[model samples]
Target chain A: MTSPRRVTPEPFVWLMFSAGGVVAALILPVLLVLFGVAIPLGWVEAPDHAHLLAVLRHPLTRLALFGVCALALVHAAHRLRFTVEHTFRLGRYDPAIATVTYGAAAAGAAAAAYLLLTAFG
Target chain B: MISPLEARYYRRRMPLLWWAHRRSYAIFVLRELSSAFVALFIVELLLLVRATARGPAAYESFLDTMAHPAMIVLNLIALAFVLLHAITFANLTPRAMIVRLRGRRVPSRVVLAGVYAGWLLVTAFLAWLLVAA
Candidate 1:
Protein backbone atom coordinates (compact mmCIF):
# COMPACT_ATOMS: atom_id res chain seq x y z
CA MET A 1 0.00 0.00 0.00
CA THR A 2 1.13 3.52 -0.79
CA SER A 3 2.05 5.67 2.19
CA PRO A 4 0.01 8.76 2.88
CA ARG A 5 1.48 11.98 1.51
CA ARG A 6 2.74 14.50 4.06
CA VAL A 7 2.83 18.25 3.47
CA THR A 8 5.24 20.52 5.25
CA PRO A 9 6.60 24.09 4.94
CA GLU A 10 10.15 22.88 5.44
CA PRO A 11 10.93 22.23 1.76
CA PHE A 12 9.65 25.59 0.57
CA VAL A 13 11.64 27.36 3.27
CA TRP A 14 14.74 25.48 2.17
CA LEU A 15 14.12 26.38 -1.47
CA MET A 16 13.97 30.06 -0.57
CA PHE A 17 17.11 29.72 1.50
CA SER A 18 18.99 28.03 -1.36
CA ALA A 19 17.83 30.47 -4.03
CA GLY A 20 18.67 33.39 -1.78
CA GLY A 21 22.12 32.00 -1.09
CA VAL A 22 22.86 31.71 -4.82
CA VAL A 23 21.58 35.21 -5.63
CA ALA A 24 23.49 36.80 -2.75
CA ALA A 25 26.71 34.99 -3.70
CA LEU A 26 26.54 35.92 -7.38
CA ILE A 27 25.28 39.50 -7.29
CA LEU A 28 26.10 41.11 -3.93
CA PRO A 29 29.89 41.32 -4.08
CA VAL A 30 30.21 43.65 -7.09
CA LEU A 31 27.38 45.85 -5.90
CA LEU A 32 28.97 46.09 -2.47
CA VAL A 33 32.45 46.90 -3.84
CA LEU A 34 31.17 49.60 -6.14
CA PHE A 35 28.60 51.34 -3.98
CA GLY A 36 30.01 50.52 -0.56
CA VAL A 37 33.71 50.97 -1.19
CA ALA A 38 34.90 52.28 -4.56
CA ILE A 39 32.46 55.10 -5.21
CA PRO A 40 32.27 56.24 -1.61
CA LEU A 41 36.08 56.23 -1.35
CA GLY A 42 36.25 58.35 -4.50
CA TRP A 43 38.28 55.66 -6.24
CA VAL A 44 35.58 55.55 -8.92
CA GLU A 45 33.40 58.37 -10.16
CA ALA A 46 30.05 58.24 -8.46
CA PRO A 47 27.07 57.94 -10.73
CA ASP A 48 25.48 61.38 -10.94
CA HIS A 49 22.39 62.11 -8.85
CA ALA A 50 20.07 62.48 -11.85
CA HIS A 51 21.45 59.33 -13.43
CA LEU A 52 20.92 57.31 -10.26
CA LEU A 53 17.42 58.60 -9.83
CA ALA A 54 16.63 57.79 -13.44
CA VAL A 55 17.92 54.28 -13.02
CA LEU A 56 15.88 53.82 -9.87
CA ARG A 57 12.79 54.98 -11.76
CA HIS A 58 13.03 52.07 -14.15
CA PRO A 59 10.54 49.30 -13.29
CA LEU A 60 12.89 46.47 -14.22
CA THR A 61 15.70 47.80 -12.05
CA ARG A 62 13.35 48.21 -9.12
CA LEU A 63 12.01 44.69 -9.58
CA ALA A 64 15.45 43.13 -9.84
CA LEU A 65 16.66 44.99 -6.77
CA PHE A 66 13.56 43.97 -4.84
CA GLY A 67 14.21 40.34 -5.71
CA VAL A 68 17.78 40.60 -4.48
CA CYS A 69 16.89 42.34 -1.21
CA ALA A 70 13.97 40.08 -0.34
CA LEU A 71 15.79 36.86 -1.15
CA ALA A 72 18.92 37.88 0.69
CA LEU A 73 16.91 38.78 3.75
CA VAL A 74 15.20 35.38 3.73
CA HIS A 75 18.55 33.67 3.32
CA ALA A 76 19.94 35.57 6.24
CA ALA A 77 16.93 34.70 8.35
CA HIS A 78 17.24 30.99 7.65
CA ARG A 79 20.92 30.88 8.52
CA LEU A 80 20.53 33.07 11.56
CA ARG A 81 17.71 30.88 12.80
CA PHE A 82 19.83 27.73 12.80
CA THR A 83 22.95 29.49 14.04
CA VAL A 84 21.10 30.87 17.03
CA GLU A 85 19.55 27.53 17.73
CA HIS A 86 22.75 25.55 17.69
CA THR A 87 25.20 28.09 19.11
CA PHE A 88 23.01 28.89 22.10
CA ARG A 89 21.47 25.45 22.48
CA LEU A 90 18.06 27.01 22.15
CA GLY A 91 16.56 23.99 20.48
CA ARG A 92 13.76 23.90 22.99
CA TYR A 93 12.66 27.36 21.85
CA ASP A 94 12.61 26.48 18.17
CA PRO A 95 9.12 27.78 17.54
CA ALA A 96 9.81 31.19 19.04
CA ILE A 97 13.15 31.47 17.26
CA ALA A 98 11.73 30.55 13.89
CA THR A 99 8.88 32.99 14.31
CA VAL A 100 11.21 35.89 15.13
CA THR A 101 13.74 35.19 12.40
CA TYR A 102 11.27 34.50 9.62
CA GLY A 103 9.04 37.32 10.77
CA ALA A 104 11.86 39.83 10.41
CA ALA A 105 12.65 38.51 6.96
CA ALA A 106 9.05 38.83 5.85
CA ALA A 107 8.83 42.36 7.22
CA GLY A 108 12.05 43.32 5.46
CA ALA A 109 10.79 41.85 2.21
CA ALA A 110 7.54 43.76 2.53
CA ALA A 111 9.45 46.97 3.14
CA ALA A 112 11.59 46.34 0.07
CA ALA A 113 8.50 45.79 -2.06
CA TYR A 114 6.84 48.93 -0.78
CA LEU A 115 9.92 51.03 -1.44
CA LEU A 116 10.54 49.65 -4.91
CA LEU A 117 7.04 49.49 -6.32
CA THR A 118 5.11 52.30 -4.69
CA ALA A 119 7.31 54.78 -2.82
CA PHE A 120 9.82 55.08 -5.62
CA GLY A 121 7.14 55.57 -8.23
CA MET B 1 14.08 3.13 38.94
CA ILE B 2 16.03 4.22 35.80
CA SER B 3 16.04 1.71 32.96
CA PRO B 4 19.27 -0.34 32.49
CA LEU B 5 19.96 1.41 29.12
CA GLU B 6 19.53 4.89 30.66
CA ALA B 7 21.73 4.01 33.64
CA ARG B 8 24.44 2.61 31.35
CA TYR B 9 24.54 5.67 29.03
CA TYR B 10 26.57 8.81 29.69
CA ARG B 11 25.70 12.21 28.26
CA ARG B 12 28.39 14.84 28.20
CA ARG B 13 27.27 18.41 28.74
CA MET B 14 28.21 20.72 25.89
CA PRO B 15 30.25 23.78 26.84
CA LEU B 16 28.95 27.24 26.03
CA LEU B 17 31.93 28.04 23.79
CA TRP B 18 31.98 24.77 21.91
CA TRP B 19 32.42 26.55 18.59
CA ALA B 20 35.49 28.33 19.92
CA HIS B 21 37.31 25.15 20.82
CA ARG B 22 38.56 24.45 17.30
CA ARG B 23 39.75 26.48 14.29
CA SER B 24 37.31 24.85 11.92
CA TYR B 25 34.47 25.41 14.34
CA ALA B 26 35.37 29.08 14.59
CA ILE B 27 35.40 29.40 10.82
CA PHE B 28 32.04 27.69 10.64
CA VAL B 29 30.62 30.18 13.11
CA LEU B 30 32.04 33.07 11.12
CA ARG B 31 30.46 31.66 7.97
CA GLU B 32 27.14 31.55 9.77
CA LEU B 33 27.62 35.13 10.96
CA SER B 34 28.12 36.32 7.37
CA SER B 35 24.40 36.19 6.81
CA ALA B 36 24.01 39.18 9.14
CA PHE B 37 26.33 41.13 6.87
CA VAL B 38 24.28 40.13 3.85
CA ALA B 39 21.20 41.41 5.60
CA LEU B 40 22.99 44.65 6.49
CA PHE B 41 23.91 45.21 2.84
CA ILE B 42 20.28 44.77 1.78
CA VAL B 43 19.17 47.23 4.43
CA GLU B 44 21.70 49.73 3.14
CA LEU B 45 20.45 49.24 -0.41
CA LEU B 46 16.86 49.84 0.68
CA LEU B 47 17.88 53.03 2.48
CA LEU B 48 19.69 54.12 -0.66
CA VAL B 49 16.60 53.57 -2.76
CA ARG B 50 14.51 55.45 -0.26
CA ALA B 51 16.94 58.34 -0.28
CA THR B 52 16.86 58.49 -4.06
CA ALA B 53 13.10 58.43 -4.05
CA ARG B 54 13.03 61.38 -1.68
CA GLY B 55 14.89 63.61 -4.19
CA PRO B 56 18.36 64.66 -5.41
CA ALA B 57 19.31 66.64 -2.31
CA ALA B 58 18.39 63.81 0.03
CA TYR B 59 20.27 61.40 -2.23
CA GLU B 60 23.37 63.56 -2.14
CA SER B 61 23.15 63.69 1.64
CA PHE B 62 22.85 59.94 1.79
CA LEU B 63 25.98 59.64 -0.28
CA ASP B 64 27.75 62.01 2.10
CA THR B 65 26.64 59.88 5.05
CA MET B 66 27.93 56.75 3.34
CA ALA B 67 31.26 58.44 2.74
CA HIS B 68 31.70 59.26 6.39
CA PRO B 69 34.78 57.62 7.89
CA ALA B 70 32.78 55.47 10.31
CA MET B 71 30.31 54.38 7.64
CA ILE B 72 33.17 53.62 5.24
CA VAL B 73 34.91 51.49 7.84
CA LEU B 74 31.68 49.62 8.63
CA ASN B 75 31.08 48.96 4.95
CA LEU B 76 34.61 47.67 4.54
CA ILE B 77 34.10 45.16 7.35
CA ALA B 78 30.72 44.24 5.92
CA LEU B 79 32.39 43.77 2.51
CA ALA B 80 34.85 41.32 4.02
CA PHE B 81 32.06 39.33 5.64
CA VAL B 82 29.89 39.37 2.50
CA LEU B 83 32.80 38.14 0.38
CA LEU B 84 33.30 35.31 2.85
CA HIS B 85 29.62 34.48 2.50
CA ALA B 86 29.83 34.43 -1.30
CA ILE B 87 33.00 32.35 -1.50
CA THR B 88 31.90 29.82 1.10
CA PHE B 89 28.46 29.46 -0.45
CA ALA B 90 29.89 29.02 -3.94
CA ASN B 91 32.38 26.38 -2.83
CA LEU B 92 29.64 24.40 -1.12
CA THR B 93 27.40 24.49 -4.22
CA PRO B 94 29.12 21.51 -5.88
CA ARG B 95 28.48 19.21 -2.94
CA ALA B 96 24.85 20.31 -2.78
CA MET B 97 24.18 19.89 -6.48
CA ILE B 98 25.07 16.96 -8.75
CA VAL B 99 24.92 17.92 -12.40
CA ARG B 100 24.96 15.40 -15.23
CA LEU B 101 26.01 16.15 -18.75
CA ARG B 102 24.52 13.61 -21.23
CA GLY B 103 25.44 10.23 -19.77
CA ARG B 104 28.39 11.52 -17.77
CA ARG B 105 28.28 13.12 -14.34
CA VAL B 106 29.98 16.50 -14.11
CA PRO B 107 32.92 16.53 -11.70
CA SER B 108 32.59 18.65 -8.59
CA ARG B 109 35.65 20.63 -9.66
CA VAL B 110 34.03 21.41 -13.01
CA VAL B 111 30.84 22.52 -11.31
CA LEU B 112 32.84 24.72 -8.97
CA ALA B 113 34.74 26.29 -11.85
CA GLY B 114 31.47 27.02 -13.65
CA VAL B 115 30.12 28.76 -10.56
CA TYR B 116 33.18 30.99 -10.20
CA ALA B 117 33.11 31.78 -13.92
CA GLY B 118 29.48 32.85 -13.70
CA TRP B 119 30.30 35.01 -10.68
CA LEU B 120 33.08 36.78 -12.58
CA LEU B 121 30.91 37.34 -15.66
CA VAL B 122 28.10 38.78 -13.63
CA THR B 123 30.45 41.03 -11.64
CA ALA B 124 32.07 42.30 -14.85
CA PHE B 125 28.71 43.09 -16.45
CA LEU B 126 27.50 44.94 -13.35
CA ALA B 127 30.75 46.86 -13.10
CA TRP B 128 30.43 47.98 -16.69
CA LEU B 129 26.83 48.98 -16.18
CA LEU B 130 27.53 50.95 -13.01
CA VAL B 131 30.96 52.39 -13.68
CA ALA B 132 31.70 52.38 -17.41
CA ALA B 133 28.22 52.73 -18.93
Candidate 2:
Protein backbone atom coordinates (compact mmCIF):
# COMPACT_ATOMS: atom_id res chain seq x y z
CA MET A 1 0.00 0.00 0.00
CA THR A 2 1.22 3.49 -0.85
CA SER A 3 1.70 5.85 2.05
CA PRO A 4 -0.39 9.02 2.12
CA ARG A 5 1.54 12.06 0.97
CA ARG A 6 2.34 14.74 3.46
CA VAL A 7 1.19 18.24 2.64
CA THR A 8 3.17 21.41 3.18
CA PRO A 9 1.78 24.81 4.16
CA GLU A 10 3.65 26.61 1.37
CA PRO A 11 0.72 26.48 -1.04
CA PHE A 12 -1.67 27.90 1.55
CA VAL A 13 0.72 30.75 2.29
CA TRP A 14 1.08 31.52 -1.42
CA LEU A 15 -2.71 31.47 -1.81
CA MET A 16 -3.03 34.09 0.91
CA PHE A 17 -0.22 36.07 -0.70
CA SER A 18 -1.93 36.12 -4.11
CA ALA A 19 -5.35 36.99 -2.72
CA GLY A 20 -3.86 39.72 -0.57
CA GLY A 21 -1.86 41.15 -3.45
CA VAL A 22 -4.89 41.32 -5.76
CA VAL A 23 -7.11 42.90 -3.11
CA ALA A 24 -4.52 45.49 -2.14
CA ALA A 25 -3.75 46.28 -5.76
CA LEU A 26 -7.39 46.82 -6.61
CA ILE A 27 -8.80 48.55 -3.52
CA LEU A 28 -6.04 50.26 -1.56
CA PRO A 29 -5.09 53.02 -3.99
CA VAL A 30 -8.50 54.74 -3.86
CA LEU A 31 -8.65 54.35 -0.10
CA LEU A 32 -5.23 55.87 0.32
CA VAL A 33 -6.19 58.72 -2.00
CA LEU A 34 -9.40 59.43 -0.12
CA PHE A 35 -8.18 59.11 3.46
CA GLY A 36 -4.59 60.19 3.06
CA VAL A 37 -4.90 62.92 0.49
CA ALA A 38 -8.34 64.19 -0.54
CA ILE A 39 -10.16 64.15 2.77
CA PRO A 40 -7.24 65.19 4.90
CA LEU A 41 -6.22 68.02 2.59
CA GLY A 42 -9.82 69.24 2.33
CA TRP A 43 -9.81 68.59 -1.41
CA VAL A 44 -12.97 66.53 -1.00
CA GLU A 45 -15.85 66.57 1.45
CA ALA A 46 -15.01 64.62 4.54
CA PRO A 47 -17.41 62.19 6.10
CA ASP A 48 -18.70 63.54 9.39
CA HIS A 49 -18.08 61.71 12.64
CA ALA A 50 -21.57 60.19 12.90
CA HIS A 51 -21.67 59.27 9.25
CA LEU A 52 -18.28 57.59 9.45
CA LEU A 53 -19.26 55.81 12.63
CA ALA A 54 -22.44 54.50 11.06
CA VAL A 55 -20.48 53.15 8.14
CA LEU A 56 -18.00 51.41 10.40
CA ARG A 57 -20.81 49.92 12.46
CA HIS A 58 -22.15 48.07 9.48
CA PRO A 59 -21.35 44.32 9.54
CA LEU A 60 -20.26 44.22 5.91
CA THR A 61 -17.97 47.19 6.30
CA ARG A 62 -16.28 45.65 9.33
CA LEU A 63 -15.80 42.34 7.50
CA ALA A 64 -14.37 44.03 4.42
CA LEU A 65 -12.06 46.18 6.50
CA PHE A 66 -10.81 43.19 8.44
CA GLY A 67 -10.20 41.27 5.24
CA VAL A 68 -8.27 44.07 3.59
CA CYS A 69 -6.01 44.58 6.58
CA ALA A 70 -5.33 40.90 7.24
CA LEU A 71 -4.70 39.91 3.65
CA ALA A 72 -2.55 42.93 2.83
CA LEU A 73 -0.35 42.18 5.78
CA VAL A 74 0.04 38.59 4.64
CA HIS A 75 1.02 39.76 1.17
CA ALA A 76 3.57 42.14 2.62
CA ALA A 77 4.99 39.44 4.82
CA HIS A 78 5.50 37.04 1.92
CA ARG A 79 7.20 39.63 -0.25
CA LEU A 80 9.38 40.98 2.54
CA ARG A 81 10.43 37.47 3.49
CA PHE A 82 12.15 36.75 0.16
CA THR A 83 13.35 40.30 -0.30
CA VAL A 84 15.13 40.33 3.03
CA GLU A 85 16.45 36.85 2.56
CA HIS A 86 17.94 37.56 -0.86
CA THR A 87 19.12 41.10 -0.24
CA PHE A 88 20.79 40.47 3.08
CA ARG A 89 22.09 36.99 2.26
CA LEU A 90 20.30 35.52 5.25
CA GLY A 91 19.62 32.15 3.69
CA ARG A 92 21.20 30.35 6.63
CA TYR A 93 18.57 31.74 8.95
CA ASP A 94 15.65 31.09 6.64
CA PRO A 95 13.50 29.39 9.28
CA ALA A 96 13.92 32.18 11.78
CA ILE A 97 13.32 34.87 9.20
CA ALA A 98 10.16 33.19 7.98
CA THR A 99 8.90 32.86 11.54
CA VAL A 100 9.52 36.48 12.43
CA THR A 101 7.96 37.86 9.23
CA TYR A 102 4.86 35.66 9.24
CA GLY A 103 4.52 36.05 13.00
CA ALA A 104 4.38 39.83 12.70
CA ALA A 105 1.79 39.58 9.93
CA ALA A 106 -0.34 37.25 12.03
CA ALA A 107 -0.12 39.61 14.99
CA GLY A 108 -1.10 42.56 12.84
CA ALA A 109 -4.07 40.66 11.46
CA ALA A 110 -5.19 39.70 14.96
CA ALA A 111 -5.00 43.31 16.07
CA ALA A 112 -7.08 44.34 13.05
CA ALA A 113 -9.71 41.75 13.86
CA TYR A 114 -9.95 42.91 17.49
CA LEU A 115 -10.30 46.55 16.53
CA LEU A 116 -12.87 45.89 13.83
CA LEU A 117 -15.03 43.44 15.77
CA THR A 118 -15.04 45.01 19.24
CA ALA A 119 -13.59 48.50 19.19
CA PHE A 120 -15.63 49.81 16.28
CA GLY A 121 -19.00 48.75 17.61
CA MET B 1 37.47 23.64 3.73
CA ILE B 2 37.30 23.19 -0.02
CA SER B 3 37.53 19.79 -1.69
CA PRO B 4 39.68 19.38 -4.80
CA LEU B 5 36.68 18.72 -7.03
CA GLU B 6 34.71 21.70 -5.66
CA ALA B 7 37.76 23.97 -5.93
CA ARG B 8 37.84 23.41 -9.70
CA TYR B 9 34.81 25.71 -10.14
CA TYR B 10 35.01 29.41 -9.30
CA ARG B 11 32.18 30.72 -7.17
CA ARG B 12 31.67 34.46 -7.23
CA ARG B 13 29.77 35.90 -4.27
CA MET B 14 26.99 38.31 -5.14
CA PRO B 15 27.55 41.86 -4.02
CA LEU B 16 25.06 43.28 -1.55
CA LEU B 17 24.68 46.41 -3.71
CA TRP B 18 24.25 44.51 -6.96
CA TRP B 19 20.68 45.77 -7.23
CA ALA B 20 22.00 49.32 -7.24
CA HIS B 21 24.21 48.63 -10.21
CA ARG B 22 21.39 48.22 -12.73
CA ARG B 23 18.21 50.21 -13.34
CA SER B 24 16.03 47.13 -13.64
CA TYR B 25 17.57 45.66 -10.52
CA ALA B 26 16.97 48.90 -8.65
CA ILE B 27 13.34 48.95 -9.77
CA PHE B 28 12.96 45.36 -8.62
CA VAL B 29 14.34 46.29 -5.20
CA LEU B 30 12.01 49.26 -5.01
CA ARG B 31 9.09 47.00 -5.89
CA GLU B 32 10.06 44.68 -3.05
CA LEU B 33 10.35 47.66 -0.71
CA SER B 34 6.76 48.64 -1.59
CA SER B 35 5.51 45.80 0.57
CA ALA B 36 6.85 47.56 3.64
CA PHE B 37 4.76 50.59 2.78
CA VAL B 38 1.73 48.39 2.25
CA ALA B 39 2.12 47.14 5.81
CA LEU B 40 2.56 50.70 7.04
CA PHE B 41 -0.71 51.72 5.39
CA ILE B 42 -2.54 48.86 7.06
CA VAL B 43 -1.16 49.93 10.44
CA GLU B 44 -2.40 53.44 9.81
CA LEU B 45 -5.83 52.11 8.91
CA LEU B 46 -5.95 50.05 12.09
CA LEU B 47 -5.06 53.13 14.11
CA LEU B 48 -7.81 55.03 12.35
CA VAL B 49 -10.33 52.37 13.28
CA ARG B 50 -9.11 52.37 16.85
CA ALA B 51 -9.40 56.13 17.10
CA THR B 52 -12.94 56.07 15.77
CA ALA B 53 -13.88 53.45 18.32
CA ARG B 54 -12.50 55.56 21.15
CA GLY B 55 -15.10 58.29 20.45
CA PRO B 56 -15.70 61.40 18.38
CA ALA B 57 -13.07 63.40 20.23
CA ALA B 58 -10.41 60.79 19.60
CA TYR B 59 -11.38 60.48 15.98
CA GLU B 60 -11.04 64.24 15.57
CA SER B 61 -7.61 64.07 17.12
CA PHE B 62 -6.66 61.29 14.73
CA LEU B 63 -7.72 63.42 11.79
CA ASP B 64 -5.79 66.32 13.23
CA THR B 65 -2.71 64.16 13.46
CA MET B 66 -3.17 63.00 9.88
CA ALA B 67 -3.44 66.58 8.70
CA HIS B 68 -0.08 67.47 10.18
CA PRO B 69 2.53 68.48 7.60
CA ALA B 70 4.93 65.65 8.42
CA MET B 71 2.12 63.07 8.35
CA ILE B 72 0.93 64.38 5.01
CA VAL B 73 4.40 64.07 3.52
CA LEU B 74 4.78 60.54 4.85
CA ASN B 75 1.40 59.57 3.48
CA LEU B 76 2.28 61.06 0.13
CA ILE B 77 5.38 58.90 0.01
CA ALA B 78 3.24 55.93 0.97
CA LEU B 79 0.83 56.78 -1.82
CA ALA B 80 3.69 56.62 -4.31
CA PHE B 81 4.80 53.21 -3.06
CA VAL B 82 1.21 51.93 -3.14
CA LEU B 83 0.80 53.06 -6.71
CA LEU B 84 4.00 51.29 -7.66
CA HIS B 85 2.72 48.10 -6.02
CA ALA B 86 -0.66 48.35 -7.70
CA ILE B 87 0.63 49.10 -11.17
CA THR B 88 3.31 46.45 -11.12
CA PHE B 89 0.89 43.85 -9.80
CA ALA B 90 -1.66 44.71 -12.44
CA ASN B 91 0.85 44.55 -15.25
CA LEU B 92 2.14 41.19 -14.08
CA THR B 93 -1.28 39.58 -13.59
CA PRO B 94 -1.67 38.52 -17.20
CA ARG B 95 1.62 36.63 -17.09
CA ALA B 96 0.80 34.97 -13.79
CA MET B 97 -2.71 33.86 -14.63
CA ILE B 98 -3.82 31.74 -17.57
CA VAL B 99 -7.43 32.27 -18.47
CA ARG B 100 -9.14 29.86 -20.84
CA LEU B 101 -12.24 30.53 -22.95
CA ARG B 102 -14.09 27.75 -24.75
CA GLY B 103 -11.00 25.49 -24.72
CA ARG B 104 -8.86 28.18 -26.31
CA ARG B 105 -6.11 30.15 -24.56
CA VAL B 106 -7.02 33.76 -23.88
CA PRO B 107 -4.60 36.34 -25.25
CA SER B 108 -2.52 38.14 -22.61
CA ARG B 109 -3.57 41.61 -23.71
CA VAL B 110 -7.21 40.67 -23.36
CA VAL B 111 -6.59 39.42 -19.85
CA LEU B 112 -4.66 42.58 -19.01
CA ALA B 113 -7.44 44.74 -20.42
CA GLY B 114 -9.98 42.84 -18.37
CA VAL B 115 -7.94 43.37 -15.23
CA TYR B 116 -7.69 47.09 -15.89
CA ALA B 117 -11.43 47.30 -16.57
CA GLY B 118 -12.13 45.54 -13.29
CA TRP B 119 -9.83 47.95 -11.49
CA LEU B 120 -11.59 50.95 -12.99
CA LEU B 121 -15.02 49.61 -12.14
CA VAL B 122 -13.97 48.91 -8.58
CA THR B 123 -12.45 52.36 -8.15
CA ALA B 124 -15.55 54.02 -9.57
CA PHE B 125 -17.85 52.09 -7.27
CA LEU B 126 -15.72 52.91 -4.23
CA ALA B 127 -15.55 56.58 -5.15
CA TRP B 128 -19.32 56.78 -5.43
CA LEU B 129 -19.84 54.94 -2.18
CA LEU B 130 -17.39 57.05 -0.19
CA VAL B 131 -17.92 60.44 -1.78
CA ALA B 132 -21.37 60.66 -3.34
CA ALA B 133 -23.27 58.43 -0.94
The number of the candidate with the highest DockQ is 1
lDDT of 1 by residue, B1-133 (tens): 8898987895678998899999999999999999999999999989989988898888889889999999899999999999999999999989999999997989999999999999999999888876787
RMSD of each predicted structure = 1.9, 2.5
Per-residue accuracy of model 2 over B60-96 as CA lDDT, tens digit each: 9988888888888999999999999999999999899
lDDT of each model, Cα atoms only? 0.91, 0.90
lDDT leader = 1
Q: Which lDDT tens digits does candidate 1 get at residues A24-105?
A: 9999999889888998999999887777788888898888998998899999999999999989888899999999999999
Worst 10 residues of 1 chain B by lDDT: B7-16
TM-score for all predictions? 0.94, 0.93
Error of 2 at A115 (Å): 0.9
Q: List-wise, what DockQ does each model earn?
A: 0.82, 0.75
